[model samples]
Target: MTWNSKLRCFFLLWVLNSNIILASLESEVSAQSDVKDHGEHDNEDYSLERAGSFDQIFKIQQTYLTVQVDQLNSTNTPRAKDEKRRLLKELSRAHGKWGDQHPRKKLLDALFSYSRYFERNIPDVNRWRQLYNHVSSKHKRLLDRTVSYTKKFDRAESLLRQNHFLCEDVVNEALSYYEIGREELRKHIADAEKAGIVADKMSVSQSLKHIGRDWTDDGVSERDGAFPCILDSIQSLFPNRQSSRYKVLLPGSGLGRLGYDVAALGGFEVTNNEVSAYMNIMYRFIETQSKKDAFQVYPFVDGWSHHVTQDDMFYQLSFPSMTMNNSNVILVEGDFTTVFKDSKDKFDVVITHFFIDTARNLMSYFETISSLLAPGGYWINFGPLLYGTGPWVQLALDEILTVTEDMGFQFVDGPESCGSLTFPDKKVRNKEAAYGYSPRALTKNAYHAQSWIARR
Candidate 1:
């Protein structure tokens, strides 16, 4: 009786344990399935289109606000005053249009008006004092009331706007005005701090001169010697006799050495376009200095041509001011990317030295150069493409070449020339080694850079 009873009891216990384990496994699988389903549902609920649309609107608004604020904070000369008024009018109109549609619109409109008023009138001590007194008199109550009202409107608008996801496009447009208001507020603070502080004109002029000459070897002799080499390379590509009265554009003309040299060549009319206002001022200063030094040093330099006559000298401080010069130098101050915005196949030669690598938008520079070049016109670009900045230099080259060819320019000369020029940093024996160089360098970091002559 004892053996048979013990076997039956053990079998029953084992069967019960198996049933319990199966139940637990089924429960775990069901829980996991529920979790997966919940995650999928959550993902579907958070629509990417909705979030992306909102973000786009937000950014547009931010930019608009910034521009409006900047305009308000700008110097209020007659032109600036007119611009401010126009901007304020536009802001008011936008506010009026949106205020009726959205609750936050009124608050946003008030903020815009306040910004304009502050920017336009705060410069007057009397006006500012009056404003301060008014604000101080009703400080606690008015501040609380304004804050509470704005919050309420903001919440209401947010709730209403969320339901009308289709109106994301409209909301995006309103976002621009909101951004303008915000940016103006920021500029108002900055302009307020800068008020009454006049910049030193002489110091600014000197700083400009230094910046113009910064990239070159600082010694007067070195810069003077370099001019002949630069002109030789320039003349070799486009011979002086055949070059005619070619319209030459030299951008970043720090102190106008290259432009002055080209002009002095007699055949080519060089226009110097310098971005820095200080550089332009310094360029004029140098012209005066050149006159003073002309008798003493002009005859010694063999290549120094007198073709850059006083009558032939022309300069543009900024891009827009650059006059179309067929036989004279045109100095233009502008972002090279937008240089040819209105150019009508006018230029015959576009030359830049040590300008390409320094550009932030390398492709834009090449692209602009290609666009500015007339048919059969020469594009001379000489610069260090790859320096200490590793992959970025390579990427810039790729972008420049890609844009150059895309804009219908053909590379006509070698970008592979290897030569040793004196390093700007004279302290460094191995220039490449000084800038964290490895043995397996992708491009040469030698003192002398490669030159490319392209034709469009």
Candidate 2:
């Protein structure tokens, strides 16, 4: 009787425990499903979409590089062999010293061709490990397609694999910046994970190509075409010039050159706001430099095309040709609209250099600028309307001026040429501004950037 009763009680206990475990498992799965659902349904997906989009963004980057390397290394087809011969011929012409016998030719082959510069100790590229483990099946297509249709770049071949080194420069710095950003982005992802919600991804991917030359003295001509005009307008339009330094907002201040220039020139408190993590870390990198010409930049190492000479093709220049660190300059990192949305009338002047085109909706940017500037504050813009990527409304110059005026601004007469090259369309004074321009390069991507002085 005792054995039968004890066996029945043990069976009852075991059955109850199994049911409890089943219920717990069901609850956990249901909770995960609910979180997944929220990510899909909510505007801000706190799910796989948001969390995994930027996860291993470097995978695409590296894959693209690998694709490029493969292209340069490929000599299978007739076209490839012809291309190789052509490149060797070009190299032969480049340096009477460019031949195989030259010391630098051998050195460059070791430095770029065979070196693990893009991998190994590089912190930015290496940091992808954290994000690499999270790319869900959904976003795998992005990684797959980045280099799928990518063809050999229509560039001159480099016998020593020197053509794409410009990409290497920017990628290293960009990935380094990505490392800094990755840490911050992980924080947001973790918070969302704890809350079981999808978080918004970090900053949009911005081209970091300019980062290579942003801090260099080679960029001085580009700056002269814009920065001096920005300062002149600020000094002329701003009141109480001698009394106190006026707050000037410089959005898209890459590597802090324009902002530092204004601060160094005196009479202005410069706020350098940048969105690219690449630029921010690079700026911080420059800020830490104790001496001038601390770094070297090869702006044209990638420009195998559009070059008349080997010197132009393989020019070497020092970064920060001069480091003008001023305490008056403060950098704010984030989107222009989001960072200063609430700060109405906070700036005495707003200067945009090659920045207006950065907006998809120029009206939104104008509104933000209007709100940020106090009454009688001036907005001096110097940049061509080269609307790039995304859904940018490519408005004609006349339309832009009209819309800008409609956005509650009065164009004040200024200099005939803001800096260099003038465009005569509207009565308002405007001019062309060049960015990343080097006269040394046979081909230049100079822009007739419209310049204007508008009062809010």
Candidate 3:
């Protein structure tokens, strides 16, 4: 063989080997990047722990109150009024101490937001009124003050919006006062419990009694209460059925307000599937009370109350099995994405409030809903879409809507305020003027939010 031919052959072989190595390196990098992206997305899917901090605090408070109440319940001797006052004072002091120690603006904001959300959503008017009355007067006063402060803060926000200067010191001072007010208000719940003024379970009879009471008024009315406005919008979408045969399902049904309302609507059989055992037990107790009262009222007001048979209401503390039934309101307890993967039947209407945005897998939730909802069925949901710690790693409203459309649902209506109450700006909007600011542009880094309603 010639020397030139040998050199050319060697160079070509070397070039080919180099290209193969480069391709291999590129593939490895691409795979690693894909894995990293998947991990990041997975981390953002659900924020159960993030959302539960306030719930944990409230639960701890409830535990202490329950223990004290049990002690009081077991006692044969009736305590003097003075002793009651002392107990109340002690409880209030304990709560105040805890609040001072925690001192989390985020926690306070979340609680207030959740309460406001509840006040707008839940369907039952009577239950709403009960919850409003259940809140301590001190809490009410503080909430009122917070609302007023929020309006003032909004003025500053508006000024900022218009690119005007705001005093940062003034804003900070107002926020400080608002925080103090919230702490004081929290103490009121403990104080009330110590005074033996507890808001017990709302029986069906009690709920019915409160119905139609000041329906037009938003001040502690039967329809506007603790659960929120989002829940009510979902309820409104369930067209009235003549027979007590309609079935409803609620996954992640915390405290079961929406589920109970569906059951109360008469013709619908409702199931509340909750992940938390504590929530499940609480819901079951409430449902039992409702059933007992319902049985009592059923005979006299035939057709006034939609008769919900015990068999119609089912609950599972885990994810639902793939079985579908026409008369069943199945509450499946499990990871929402994995549950019903093989389910053959779709719902007439799927209801959710504040559930989708809370999930890191916003797309998965929408896809699951689309799969579960029958053609021409409705998807009724309401909740604030805001950036926060926990499940919501980022605020991507456009991304969310895009995913919803991909899942075959159309945006029906909403982004409207669910209830009569105004958004509290004191929590979200910064008041730079109150806090003392130099003549610099105030960057609007506030969380953007809107309530939505969509249909399939």
Alpha-carbon TM-score of each model against the true structure: 0.40, 0.55, 0.36
lDDT of 3 by residue, 1-456 (tens): 110101111111123422311121111111111121222322221211122232221111110111121112111123223322432343343444465223232223222222222122222433444566777888878966865422432332222211100111111122232223433434543454466642322222122222212111211322233234444555566555674365455666664445644654556655445543223322322222201111111111111122243111111011111111212233444456764575565776666644665677566677777777777776765444543466634545556666667666676543233432223421111111111011121322222224445677
Where model 1 places Cα greater than 4 Å from the true spot, the runs are: 1-221, 224-226, 240-243, 288-290, 294-327, 386-403, 414-446
lDDT of each: 0.40, 0.52, 0.36
Off by more than 4 A, model 3: 1-240, 290-330, 386-393, 414-449
lDDT of 2 at 141: 61
Error of 2 at 420 (Å): 9.7
Clash pairs for candidate 2: 46-197, 46-198, 47-198, 95-98, 384-449
* Weakest 10 consecutive residues of candidate 2 by summed lDDT: 1-10
Best by TM-score: 2
**Ranked by lDDT, top first:** 2, 1, 3
Evaluate candidate 2 by giving its C-alpha RMSD to the native, one decimal: 25.4
For candidate 3, the 10 contiguous residues with the lowest summed lDDT are: 430-439
